[model samples]
Target: MRFASIGSGSRGNGTLVQDGDTCVLVDLGFTIRETEKRLARLELAASAITAILVTHEHIDHLNGVGPFARKYSLPVYMTPGTYNREKIGLMPALELINCHQSFAINGFTVVPVPVPHDAKEPCQYLISSGSSTFGILTDLGHITPHVAEQYSRCDGLLLECNHDPDMLAEGPYPYPLKVRVGGDHGHLSNSQAAGLLSQIELSRLQHLIIAHISEENNSIEIVRKEILATLGEWQGYLTIADQGTGFGWITLN
Candidate 1:
């Protein structure tokens, strides 16, 4: 299996995961044109994607989902609440996913895990094909036991390190906004993300991509240093997803 990110930040987010003949997109936060450009950067085309899995109804994650799906005649899977809350322009194929249910579309298996976020029935995803699994956990405030269990055995993970508490506390965001971001239902701090990493079994983990960083309150240097320190003795490749370039494809066994 192989995975790559289109972009990761408050501005927008998208990830492409492929196994054998099946390719899927998790989130569509850019316009059709921009998505095309990003895909080209990775040597991928719109027609290659088999489906789009939406995590929530946030604008950054929903901006181009409907249009892109319609344009490509691709299927979109999300919770009923998220579907109802989203005002996507139009869609040709849409499927409402039930939280906690395991389903397969095309040749991939999807496990939707519920998350606590300020959205209508938001959920993160764990995708598997053959013997490999990829865990994508972002835009959630806290990690529940269920989440920890589901993600503990993944071969590759795209974890969110949205901000640093100290930077956010002193950064330019307003007081309430700061509180919300630092609260239990906003975003995960660098420490929180690192803490989750410590709990996962790292022996089989080949790559770790830190994603969805806040451009206004966090810097790559800050997150890199913090996460590197947290690694301690674990041997794994680490990469950061940028708002513009995201990251290149990394394959797992």
Candidate 2:
């Protein structure tokens, strides 16, 4: 299986995953034209995507999902609550998903895990095929036991280290907004993400992509340093997903 991201941050987020003949896109925060351009950068065409899986109803995550899905005639999957708030005219095909249930589409098994986030119905995804498992954990305010357990064994993990607590505290965001970001239903701090990595099985974890970083409150250097310190002696591939242009394809064999 192989996966890549167009970009990942508060401004926008989109991830492309492919296994054999099945190609799926998770989240769409860019405009249709922008998404096409990003896809081209990765040598992909928009029409190749078979489905779109939405994480929540947040504009940064759903902004382009409906438009792109409808344009491409791709099936979209999301929670019922999320569907309620979405503009139905945007998506050509829509599928309501249960947060705790597992569904199969185009030969890939998708398991949605509920998350603590300030959204109508937010969830993270765990995608698996015959050979590999990929986990996408972003937009969550705090890590739940269920989430940690489900994501522990993934072969490739895209984790959210939204911001550095110290930096966030001193950043320009107003009092309430800052509190919300650092709260239980906000976003994960760098330390929190690093700490979670320590508990997971790193032996089989081939790739660790730190994603959803706050441009105003965090830096790649800070996140890397924290993760390295938390990793102790374990050695693994690490990359940070950027907002302008996210890292390229990561293939797990």
Candidate 3:
């Protein structure tokens, strides 16, 4: 299995996961044209996507999902709550997923784990193909015990390190917005993301992609320092997903 990010930041987000002939997109935050252009950077076309799985109704995650899926005539899966909350129009193929259930799409097995985000029925995805498992967790304020357990044994993880607490506290997001971003239903701080490493099994983990970074409130250097400090001697391929270029594909054998 291999995965790549189309983009990752407060502006937009999208990830592509594939195994052999099966390819899926998780969250498409850009417009249809922009998404196609970004996919071109990864040497992929819209028709190559087998399906689209959405994490929530947030614009940065759901904006392009409907248009892209509709254009490609691809199936889209999301929780009912997410579907209802978003004005995504009509889709050619729509599948309502239960957050607590694991479902199969094409050749991939997808497990949706509920997360405590501001969105109604927000959840992250754990995708598995053959012996490889790739987990994506983002937009949550804190990691729940259930989340910790679910993501404990992933082969590759795209974890969110949204902001630096100090920077967020002092940055220019206004007081209420800052409180919301740092609140229990907002985003995860760098320290909070680093703290999760202690609860997961990273022995067999291969790739760790830092995602959903706040351009205004966080820096690559700060996130790297905190995560590296938390990881200590652990040896894993670490990559940061950028807002413009995102990151290249990393294969897991």
Candidate 4:
């Protein structure tokens, strides 16, 4: 299995996961043209995607899903609560998923784990192909015990290290907006993400991708410090998914 991201940040987000002949997109936030260009950078054609799995209804994650799916004639899967029929317009193929259940999409087994985000029915994904498990975890505020347990044995993980508490506290956002962002239902702070890294089985992980960073409230230096502080001597590969152009494909063997 291999996974790559087109972009990841507050402005937009999209990730591509491929296993054999099946390639799926977790979310598409860029415009149709932007998505196409980004895919080309990954040496992929837009038509190569077999489906799209939406996590929530946030514009940064849902903006291009509708148009992209319609253009490519791809199947889309998401929890009913996350689906906005009117907002998304018409779909070529729609599959309503139960957040609590696991479903098969060709060669992959997708497990939708519900997360604590302010969106209607947000959920991250754990995709398994044979013995290789790759997890796409982002947008959640805090790590739940259930989430921790479910992600305990991932081979590759794309984790959200959204912001630094100190930076967020002093940033330009208004008080209420700051409160909401730092709240229990908002994005995870750098320390919170480090806390999750510590709790998981770090030995089994091959790739640790820091994702969903806030452009204004966080920086590469801050996230680096937290990750280094938590990783200690662990020698797994580490890369930050960029908002402009996300990192290249990392395969799990």
Per-residue C-alpha lDDT of model 2 across residues 65-182, encoded as one tens digit per residue: 8778878889999999888876756567779999989999979999999999988889989999986899999988888899889999999999999999889999999999999999
Candidate 2 accuracy as TM-score: 0.98
Clashing pairs in 2: none
lDDT of 2: 0.91
In model 1, what are the clashing residue pairs, if there are any? none
Pull out the clashing pairs in model 4.
none
Candidate 2, superposed: residue stretches over 4 Å from native: 88-90
Positional deviation of 89 in candidate 4, in angstroms? 0.7
For model 1, what is the error of residue 126's alpha carbon versus the real structure, in angstroms, after optimal superposition?
Answer: 0.6
lDDT of 4 by residue, 1-253 (tens): 9999999988999999998889999999999999999999999988789999999999889999999999999999999898853379888999999999999999999999999998999999999999999999899989999999999899999999998988999999999989888989999999999999899998989999999999989999989998989999887899999999998999987
For model 4, the superposed segments whose C-alpha errors exceed 4 Å read none
Taking all chains together, each candidate's TM-score versus the true structure is: 0.97, 0.98, 0.99, 0.98
> How many collisions between residues are there in candidate 1?
0
Structural RMSD, model 3: 0.7
Answer with 2 or 4, whichever has the higher lDDT.
4
Which TM-score value belongs to model 4? 0.98
